[model samples]
Target: MATLAPQAPWAMRLVTDRRPIGPPSYAAVTLDASTQRARYTDTAGQVVKMGEHGTNQTNPTTSMSGGGDGAEPQPQTADDSTPDYSSD
Candidate 1:
């Protein structure tokens, strides 16, 4: 006999539209294996069902053309000049 493995849930934020104007909270998501549908459960134990408008994955507003916000800052090189401690 084979045992079925448990499904791992992921984090998701619900939004009414692409602008993300809705409840300011994140939910834990788990996809149904048989239905292949996603279920969202918020911290308050509320299960949100799909609305008549349906759902769409929104694209990120920010651009990552050059590493976006997390780009590492370039390090500055130290000057090779020796210390000028000889004050007259």
Candidate 2:
């Protein structure tokens, strides 16, 4: 007889309650799993569930993008006398 593995639970819901106050237009949110629930805290730090929550995978990529002109920094050459502190 073979034993079956346990099934995984449903994904959590990502809730966006309100818009962020600072720059970079972010949202105040919370993630509530199927087996567990999460509460959002207000400006006064009171926990409450005010907005609708849903299960949605936002970004699939977990890696950071190469920012700043989208160009990799050129490696220093041996002829460059910037300073070879490696000898120290």
Candidate 3:
């Protein structure tokens, strides 16, 4: 299963036929980005095309927040392989 877009609530699935053969479990079908066409795989392992398809255009923000003074201190790992002999 794949999302129509980033953080989209609607999910889609790949199918050979677009027509409703039985009960449809998917909300929509996968589409080609460039041609804006509906795409699916046939029984012969070839891609099948259908009517034009479109989806909501979303510009996902890739920016991440930088570490600042308000940020919590990261945990420090201590090596325990060496045995303490000072108490001997």
User: TM-score: which candidate is best?
Assistant: 1
Write the residue-wise lDDT of candidate 3 on 1-88 in tens digits. 9766565343444334767678433345567799996667655546655445455444433433344465695544443343333221
Q: What order do candidates take by lDDT, descending?
A: 1, 3, 2
Residue 38 miss distance in model 2 (angstroms): 1.5
Top-down TM-score ranking:
1, 3, 2
Q: Candidate 1: misplaced stretches above 4 Å? A: 1-20, 24-26, 44-46, 53-88
For the record, the alpha-carbon RMSD of candidate 3 to the native fold, in angstroms, is: 22.9
**lDDT at 27, model 1:** 73
Cα deviation at 31, candidate 1, in Å, is 0.5
TM-scores, all models, native as reference:
0.29, 0.19, 0.20
- Candidates' C-alpha lDDT: 0.56, 0.48, 0.51
lDDT of 1 by residue, 1-88 (tens): 9998875554333423567568745477888799998777788768776545444444333322333345686544433434333222
**Model 2, CA-based lDDT:** 0.48
- At residue 37, what lDDT does model 3 achieve? 66
